[model samples]
Target: MPTLLDIEAEARGCVRCPLSEGRTQVVFGVGNPNADLMFVGEAPGQQEDLKGEPFVGRAGKLLDQLVMEEMGLTRDSFYVGNVLKCRPPGNRDPKPEEIESCRPYLEKQIELIDPNVIVTLGNFATKLLLNTTQGITKVRGQTYPYGKATLVPTFHPSAALQGGGGDVISKMRADLVRAKKVLATC
Candidate 1:
C-alpha cells in the first residue's frame, strides 16, 4: 500500500478541483499516521492554506487547548486533516463539486491512518462522514459507527470563537471526551 507520505506527495500535484488552481499549496493532512484519533475539518482556512498545515490558526489554538484538556493528549498524538486539501477562495463553504473532487484524498487518508475514532469539527466534515445533511448543532455530541471507527461530531473551533460562546465550547469539550472514550475501547 502507498504510505501517507506517498499519498501526500501525490496530492500536492493534484488538479482535480478548481480550488487547487488558486492554492499556494496542498494542505495535506498532518499528525500521527497511526493515530487512534483523527480530526477532520471542513477545509483549510487562510492560515492553514498559507502554512500548509491544518488547524494552526486562532481557532486551532482553541482546538489544541481543548484536545489537551479533554483527551490528555497533544495535537501530535492524533491525525488532523480537512475535507478539501486546497483552500476555497475567500474561505467560502466548499461547493459540492469541490467536495466530490477531493473526497478520494480524504478517503485515502482515512484508509491509511485507520484511526479508531474520527472527531469531525464542523458541518462539512460531520455531514460528509455521516452521510447526512444534518447540521452540527443537531448532531454534535453524538457518535456513529463509520467503517472501522466511531465518528463524533462537534462544532468547529471557529464557531466557538465566532460568537458561539461558552455553549459551543462546552459541547466541543464533551465531544472530545467522547472521542477519547471511543479510543479507549478501540
Candidate 2:
C-alpha cells in the first residue's frame, strides 16, 4: 500500500479535475496515520489552500478545540482530511464532476488508514461517503456501518461559524460525546 506521503505527492501533481488549475496546493490529510478515528470534511478552505493542510482555518480552530479540549483528543491522535484535495473556487461547494474525479483518492486514503471510526463533517463528506442525498441535519449524530468502518455524520465546525447558534453548538457537543463513547466501545 502507498503511504500517505506518497499519496500526498501524487495529489500535488493531479489534474483530475479543473480544481487543480485554481488551487494553490492540494490540501491532503494531516495527523496520525495510525489513528483510530478519521475526520472527513468537505474541501479545503482558503487557509488550507494556502498552507497545503486540511482543516487549519477558523473551522479548523473550532474542530481543534472540540477534538482536543472537549473530546480529549489531539491533532496527532486522529487523521483529518477532506473529500476533495483541492479547493473549489471562491470556497463554493464542490461540483459533481469534481467530486467524481477526486473520490478515488479519498477512498484510497480510507483504505490505507483503516480507522475504526470515520466522522463525516458536514453534508458533502457525509453524502459522498454514505452515497446519499440526506442532509446533515437529518443524519448528524447517527452511526452507520460502511464496509468495515463505523461512520458518524456530524455538522461541520464551519456551521458554528455560520451562526447556527447555541442550539447547534449544544447538539454538536452532544454528538461529540456520542462519538467518544462509540470510540471507547469500539
Model 2 Cα lDDT, one tens digit per residue, 1-186: 688788888988999889999999899898888888999999999999999899999999988887776689989999999999999989999999999988988998998899989989999999999999999999986799977889988899999889996777777788788778889998
Predict model 2's lDDT versus the native. Answer: 0.89
RMSD of each: 0.8, 1.0
Best by lDDT: 1
TM-score of each: 0.98, 0.97
Q: Note the clash tally of each candidate.
A: 0, 0
Provide the lDDT at 117 for model 2: 91
Give every collision pair in model 2.
Answer: none
- TM-score, structure 1 vs. true: 0.98
lDDT of 1 at 102: 87
